[model samples]
Structures are given as C-alpha cells and as structure tokens.
Target: MYAVFKRELMGLLNSLMAYITIGVFLLATGLLLWFFPDTSILEYGYAELTGFFSLAPFLFMFLIPAITMRSFAEERREGTYVLLAIRPVTDWQIILAKYFACLVLVVFALIPTLIYYYTIYQLGLPQGNIDGGAVTGSYIGLLLLGSAFVAVGIFTSSLSKNQVVAFALSVFICFIAYSGFDAVSQLFVLSYFETVFLSLSVNEHYQSISRGVLDTRDLIYFITFVALFLIATKAVTGGRKW
Candidate 1:
C-alpha cells in the first residue's frame, strides 16, 4: 500500500498535476478572499471564511474531479492495471492507496489556505474576533466533503478507460451527490419523500457541519458515503476479473 501510495504521489508530482491543483485552488481562494475588491471577503463584515467556505465546495465540484479523474482510468488505459492485479496487493489496498494519495493531495492543496487565516487574523477588527472553533469546524467539514468527493471520483474513474469520460462522470456524480437531492427534495413530485431524500443528500450534512456544530451524525454520513463508494469501486474492479 505504501509503495503504491508513494508511486501514485510521485506520479502526480511528476506530471505537475498536484502543483496545478493546489495552485488553482489557492489562486481562486485568494482572488475570492482578497484580490477582487468588490467581492472580496475583506470587504464583508464577517471575520470568518463564511464567503470562502461557501464558495469552495462549489469550486471543488470541478477541481476535485479534475484531480481524481486519472486515478484508475489512467492505469486501465495504459494496461498497467493487469500488472497491479498480478501483484501481492489486495484490491482493498489498491483502492485505499489511491484514495490516500488523493487525500494527501487534498490536504496539500488546503494547507496553503492557512495563510488566509493569518491575514484575516491580522485584519480582524479586534485583532482576531474570528470564531476559532467555527473556523476549525468548517475546515474539518471541508476535508470530509472533499474525501467523499474523491471517493466518488475514484469510483467513477474505475468505471471507464477514458479519462475524459471519467472526469465528466465524476463531476456529474459529485455535483449530483452534493446538490441533487436538495434540488429533488424541493420538487413537488418528490414532496412526499422530501424528508427522506434531504437526509440522504450530502449538502444537508455539509451545511450542518459548516455551522460549526460538530454533529456526529453529519460526520458519520460523510464517512459512510465515502466508504460506500470505495466498496462499490472494489466490487466493480473485482467483477472485471470474474
């Protein structure tokens, strides 16, 4: 798993995908938070990243899929999956190694945002009037949300050999998982099942946790969502050999 993890990470860095993802995330966040004078968070009265966090998940709709589209699709396209299959590694390990590699990239992409915290801190009206607990909670929520999206992307990537198809499917799945249920629940036809559907939606839990409440139910929802997709990927890959 470690070897696979390292290899995957090295590949991302070698191709500069990791750098590009992080750079884009930072550039977008920076522009939203500081650069654009009219829409900048600094112009707003809120000290916390209410604007930043609210905008990020939507941006990640594209960015996370872009980062994860190649995870297994590229392997299958290059015919390296067979080589991986002949190795001693279990499918679980292979899935996890890829998942962890993507997670590492997500964390790497997020770490640079700490600078935004510092900037906000220094610029706060009372020298850090920001809610520390709320910021921490939001960051945790963001990580969980990203993890679930990564798992979804990986599963979608595993379903296709073409990276473009994988990317498109990933984005569609991510967007739907994140917001589809919320949209569906609003429709009159689904009104009877509205409560049930909303509960199943990713955005519901994300919004709950984003409020800085740290609800265990919301966290469990994210963990289970990620695990479910990972398991589905494993089942799909296993079926390929059978």
Candidate 2:
C-alpha cells in the first residue's frame, strides 16, 4: 500500500497536468477573490474570506475531475491497469492510493490560497479582526468537500477507459452530489421532502461546517460520502478479471 501510494503521488506530482491544474485553480480563485467585481472581497470592502469559500467548491467541481480523470482511465486505455492489478497491492489500496494522490494535488492547489487569508487578516480594520475560527472551519469543510469530489472522480475514472468520458462523468456526478439535491429540494413539488433532499447535498454539510461549528452529523456525512464512492470504485475495478 505504501509503495502504491508513493508511486501514485509521485506520478501525479511528476505530471505536467498536475501543475497545470494547480496553476489554473490558483489563478481562477485568485481572480475571483481579488479582482472579479461580483465575487471580489476587495470590492466587498470586508475582511472576510466568504467570497473565496463560496466560490472554491465550484472550482473543485471541475479541477478535481481533471486531476483524477486519468487515474484509472489512462491505465486501462494503455493496458497498464492489468499490470497494476497483478501487483501485491489490494484493490482498495489501489483506489485509495489514486484518490489520495489526486487529493494531495487538490491540497497543493489550496495551500497557496492561504496568502489570501493572510492578506485579509492584515487588511482587517483593527488589524487581525478577521474571523479566524470561521476561516479555519471553512478550510476544513473545503478539504472534506474536495476529498468527496476526489472519490467521485476516482470512481468515474474507473468506469471508463477514455479520459474525456471519465472527466465528463466525474464533473456531472460531482455537480449533482454537491448541488443537484439542494436544487431539487427547492422545487414546489418536492417541498414535502425538502429536508431529506437537502440532507443529501454536499452543499448542506459544507455550509454547516463553514459556519465554524464542528457538527458531527456533517462530519459523518462527508466521511460516508467519500467512503461510498471509494467502495464503489473498488467494486467497479474488482469486477474486471484483471
């Protein structure tokens, strides 16, 4: 497992795609947080990172899929998945290795955003008047959201040999998991089950955590969400004779 994990992580870090993904995420978020009038914190005249926290998941929706699309898809397309399957690692290990590798790339993309936090901290009217707790909580929530998305991407990548198909499927599933349920709940016809539908959205739990409250229910939901997709990926991969 350690060997697989190392190999997977190194492979991602070594790839030009990984850097491009990180660069794009940073560049886009930077623009949204500091330049884009509508979402820009500077325009809001507030020392809060609310703009960033709110906009990041949307970026993750596309960024994570790009990172994970080739995890299994390329391997299978290139006839290397069979070679990998014969390795000493178990199916779960392989899935997790790829998942974590993609997640770490996501983390690398997020790390640079701390500069925004620092800027906000310093820009606070009283100097450091920013809501540190809320910022911390938002970062935690974002990480969990990214983890769940990574699992979804990994599962989708396993389902197709073509990277484009995997990428598109992952983005669609990530969008639905994150916001589709909430959108459905808002429909007049679904009013009776609005709570149930909202509960199923990644947005709901993410919002709960973003408020700086460490709710166990929200934490559990994220864990369960990630686990389900990882297990599904394992199942999909296991079905193959390789």
Candidate 3:
C-alpha cells in the first residue's frame, strides 16, 4: 500500500497537468479572495475567511477531478489495469493508495490558501483578532470535503478507461453528492423527507462542521462517504478483475 501510495503520489507530482491543476486552483482562489473586486476581502470589510471557504468548494469541483481523472483511467487505457489487478496488493489497498495520492495533491493546493488566513489575521483592526477556532474549523472542513471529492473522483476513474469521461463523470457525480440533497430539500412534495435528504448532502454536513463546532454525525458522515466509495471501487474492480 505504501509503495503504491508513493508511486501514485510521485507520478502526479511529476506530471505537468498536476502542476497546472494546482496552479489554476491557487490562482482562482487568489483572484477571488484578494484581487477580484466583487468578492474581494477589501469589499467584505471583515477579518473572516468566509468568502474563501465559500468559493473553495466550487473550485474543488473541477480541480480535484482533474487530478484524479487519470488514476485508473490511464492504467486501463494503457492496458496495464489487468496487470495491476494481479498484483500482490488487495483491491482496497490500490484504491486507497491512489485516493490518498489525490488527497495529498488537493491538500497541497489548499496549503497556499493559508496566506489568505494570515492576511486576514494581520489586517484585523486588533491585528490578529480573527476567530482562530472558525479558521481552524473551516480548514479542517475543507480538507474533509476535499477528501470526499478525491474518493468520488477515484470511483469515477475506476469506472472508465477514458480520462476525459472520468473527469466529466467525476465532476457531475461529485457536484450531485455535494449539493443534490439541498435541492431535494427544497421540493415541497418531499417535505417530509427534507431533513433526511439534507442530512445526506455534503454541503449541509460541511457547513455544520465548518461553523467551528465539530459534530460527531458530520465526521461520521464524511468518513462513511469516503469509505463507501473506496469500498465500492474495490467491489467493482474485484468483480471484473477476478
């Protein structure tokens, strides 16, 4: 597992697309949080990073998929997937190793956003009056949310041999999981089920924990979401591989 993890992570780091994906993520976030006049920090007139958190999810919708689209898709494309299946590693180990590689890249992309946090912390009237709890909570929430995205991406990647299809499918599926429940909650016909629907959505659970209060339910929800996809990927591949 560690060997697969190292190889997967190194492969991404060595690729030009990986750098471009991370670059675009950082650039987009930088523009929105600091340079762009509309949602810029200057316009918010506050020492909070709410806007940054708000925009990150949308950015991740594509950036993460781009990173993970090639995980299994490329292997199948190059006719190496069968060889991978016969390796000494368990299917879960392979899936998890690739998943963690993408997660690390997503985390790498997010690390630069700390500059936004520092800037807000220093720009406060009291020069560090920022809510440390909320900042920490938001970052943690983002990491978990990103991890979920990586899992979704890997699942989609495992489903197809075409990287483009993998990317598109991953993006659509991730978006639905992230926001579909809230949409269902708005339907009056499903009003009775609204609570349950909202509970299943990543956005709602993310907002719950991102508020600086860690809820056990929210943590379980994310972990289960990730585990489900990882297990599903293993099951799907095991069926065909064996």
Candidate 4:
C-alpha cells in the first residue's frame, strides 16, 4: 500500500497536468478572493473569509474531477490498469492509494489559500481580529469535502476508460452530492422529507462545521460517503477480468 501510495503521489507530482490543475485552482480562488469586485474580501468589508469558504466547494466540484479523471480512466485506456490490478496489493490499497494521491493534490491547491486568511487577518481592524475558530473549522470542512469528492471521482473513473467521460460524471455527481439534496428539500411535495433530504446534503453538514462546531454526525456522514464510493470502486475493479 505504501509503495503504491508513494508511486501514485510521485506520479501526480511528476505530471504537468497535476501542476496545471493546481495552478488553475489557486488562480481562480485568488481572483475571486482579491480581484473580483463581487466576491472580493475588500467589497465585503469584513475580516471573515465567508466568501472564500462559500465559493470553494463549487470550485472543488470541477477541480477534484479534473484531478481524478485520469486515475483509472487513463490507466484503463492505456492498458495499464490490468498491470495495476494484478499487483500483490489488495484492491482497497490501490483504490486508497489513488484516492489519497488525488486528495493530496487537492490539499496542495488549498494550502496556498492560507495566504488569503493571513491577509484578512492583517486587514482586520484590530489586526488578527478574524475568527480563527471558524477559519479552522472551514478548512477542516473543506478537507473532508475534498476527500468525498476524490472518492466520487475515483468511482466515476472506474466506470469509464474515457477521461472526459470520467471527468463529466465526477463533476455531475459532485455537484449533486454537494447541493442536490438541498434543492430537493425545497420542493413542496418533499416537505415531509425535508429534514431527511437536507441531512443527506454535504452542504448541511459542512455549514454546521464551518460555524466552528464539529459534530460527530457530520464526521460519520463524510466517512460513510467516502467509504461507499471506494467500496463501489473496489467492486468495479474486482469484477473486471484484469
């Protein structure tokens, strides 16, 4: 597992696409946080990074799929997946290795955003008057959210040998997972099940944690969400002739 993990991580780092993906993510977030008049922190007149935290998940919907689209799709298309499947390691290890590699890349994209936090911290009227707890919680929520998206991406990648197909499917699923439930809950016909639908949405739990209060239920939901997709990927791989 460690060998596969290391290899996968290095492979991502060595790929130009990986760097481009991360670069684009950073560039987009930087523009939205500082340059864009609408979402800019300067326009908000607040030390809080609420705008950033609110916009990141939507960015992630596209970013994570781009990172994970080739995880299995490219391998399968290039006839490398068979070699990977027949390795000594368990299927779970391969899935997890690929998942973590993609997730680490997502983290690389996120780390630079800390500069936004620091800038806001300094920009505070009292200098460092920003809500540190909420920032910490939002970062944590973003990490969990990214992890779930990686799982979703890996699963979608396993379903197709075409990278574009994998990317599109992953993005669609990520969008639905993040907010589709909330949209469903808004329906008058679903009003009786509104609580159930909202609880299933990633935004509901994420919003809870972004408030600086961590709940075990949200943690468990994310864990289950990740596990389900990974297990689904394992099923897909295991059934293949490889």
Residues 1-242, model 3: lDDT tens digits? 99999999999999999999999999898888888889999887989999999999989999999999999999988988788778899888888889999999988898888988888888999999799998899999999999999999999898999999999998998899988878888884556688878888999988988899999999999999999999888877777785
Model 3 residue 202 distance off true place after TM-score fit, in angstroms? 0.4
Per-candidate clash tally: 0, 0, 0, 0
Ranking the candidates on lDDT from highest down gives: 4, 2, 3, 1
In terms of TM-score, how similar is model 2 to the real structure? Answer: 0.97
State the lDDT of candidate 1 residue by residue for 1-242, as single tens digits: 99999988887767676678778888888888887887688677677788888888988887888888899999999999999888999999999999988888888888888888888888888999788887888898899999999999899989999989998998998889889998988884546689888988988998888888998899789989999999999999998943
lDDT computed for candidate 1:
0.87
Candidate 4 has its poorest 10 consecutive residues by lDDT at: 187-196
Model 2, 109-145: lDDT tens digits are 9888999999999999999989999999999999999
Q: Judge candidate 3 against the unseen true structure and give its global Cα lDDT, from 0 to 1.
A: 0.91
Off by over 4 Å in 3: none
Candidate 1: residue 190 lDDT (0-100) = 47
State each model's CA lDDT, in order.
Answer: 0.87, 0.91, 0.91, 0.92
Quote each prediction's TM-score. 0.95, 0.97, 0.97, 0.97
Evaluated against the true structure, the overall lDDT of model 4 is 0.92
Top candidate when judged by lDDT against the true structure: 4
Model 1 per-residue lDDT at 208? 86
